[model samples]
Each structure stands twice: as structure tokens, then as C-alpha cells.
Target: MSKGVKTITDAEFETEVLQAEEPVLVYFWASWCGPCQLMSPLVNLAANTYSDRLKVVKMEIDPNPLTVKQYQVEGVPAIRLIQGNNILASAEGVMGKEKLISFLDTHLN
Candidate 1:
């Protein structure tokens, strides 16, 4: 993990995301999306807060088209919570700190 968060790409998806031992939170984003940029710091903050319980991964939709397709991502700033290759919950658009925390609390613990 770099800077306390793991960034997953199409090449690393299967092992780092699908087979992760702990719950995985994939933040699908793109550089062009304003909301995505705004949400990044919150994502990083959540990564720091939930360091022990989850693996927070950022997947750039533009770079990882395959992952976007596989996950059926239709928008930037999409948050997908997964466990053992199964999706537990998902949310589209930017999420605030409290909502992000609530999302993680619901799925991770």
C-alpha cells in the first residue's frame, strides 16, 4: 500500500480486489470529473480511518476501462464495497465524510 491506500488497476484487480482477505472499498474515479476530485481527500481520509478494517483502493475509470466495465461503473466517484469477490454495497457520485463512514461501517465491520 502507498500513502496508506492501495491503488488497484485492471492488472491487479483479481488478486488485490476480488481475492482480498479483508473488505475492499474501490473508489472509481477520473481526473476530469470535478466531483471525483472533490471526493478524493475524503476517500483518503477514510483510508486512514479504516486502515485496519478495510483496504481502500482507487481505480481510475479512464485508465482501467476493463474494471469499470466489469464492475458496471457508469459514473465517476463511484464507491463499491466488496468482500470475497461479492459486492456488498455501492454508491454513485461524491460522498461526504459522514456518509462514507456510514457506508464503511455498514459493510466492513
Candidate 2:
């Protein structure tokens, strides 16, 4: 995780994302996923860039099966924008920094 990005667990998912005051971008990833490694830097950048408006978090799928199942994460490198316990938007696979920013912008405003 990056400086502004929080690495959350299943136990913290409710408070960190569901009840968050601001919008949260949750990155569902695994240590062995190639695309997830590729998407990490961009996620970190987004975390720092949108720190004021969005709270970014990373949840490792392997150890947090409950959260992954709850979110219905079918694949690694899944990105979900959540606000007030609702999912605003979601995407899967590796996305570039610009596209990731655009994704965040789409729901933030």
C-alpha cells in the first residue's frame, strides 16, 4: 500500500469502506496476480491524487475471502467505488493511471 492508501482487512471493511464519510475506492487484489501488480502503482497514485475526496484501500483477496465474496469479486484487480454502503461503480482488469482517474472522477462529482 502507498502512503495515502490503506490496506484493510475483512474485519475493517465495514468501517473503512461501508461507513466511510467520503467515497472509497477499494482495490481487490492478490499477491500472485500479475495484473494486480501492474495496477498497483496507478491505484497508489489515485490514492494520493484523490486523497481529499476519496479514501483508497487495498484488500487482499486470499486472506479476506469474506469480503471478496461479499463484493462478488470475480477477478483480481477489481476496483469498486463505494459510498455510504452502496456501490457506485466497479471495473475489472488492469487500467492505466488516466483511465483510473477518469473512473474516479466519474463518480466523485
In order of appearance, the predictions have TM-scores of: 0.93, 0.95
User: For model 1, how does the per-residue alpha-carbon lDDT over 33-83 read when each residue is reduced to its tens digit?
Assistant: 999989999998988888887888998898889989988999888989988
- Tens-place lDDT per residue, model 2, 27-79, is 99999999999999898899888888889999999999999998899998999
Best by TM-score: 2
- Cα distance off (Å), candidate 2, residue 27: 0.4
Badly placed stretches (over 4 Å) of model 1 are 1-3
| TM-score, structure 2 vs. true | 0.95
Count steric clashes of candidate 2: 0
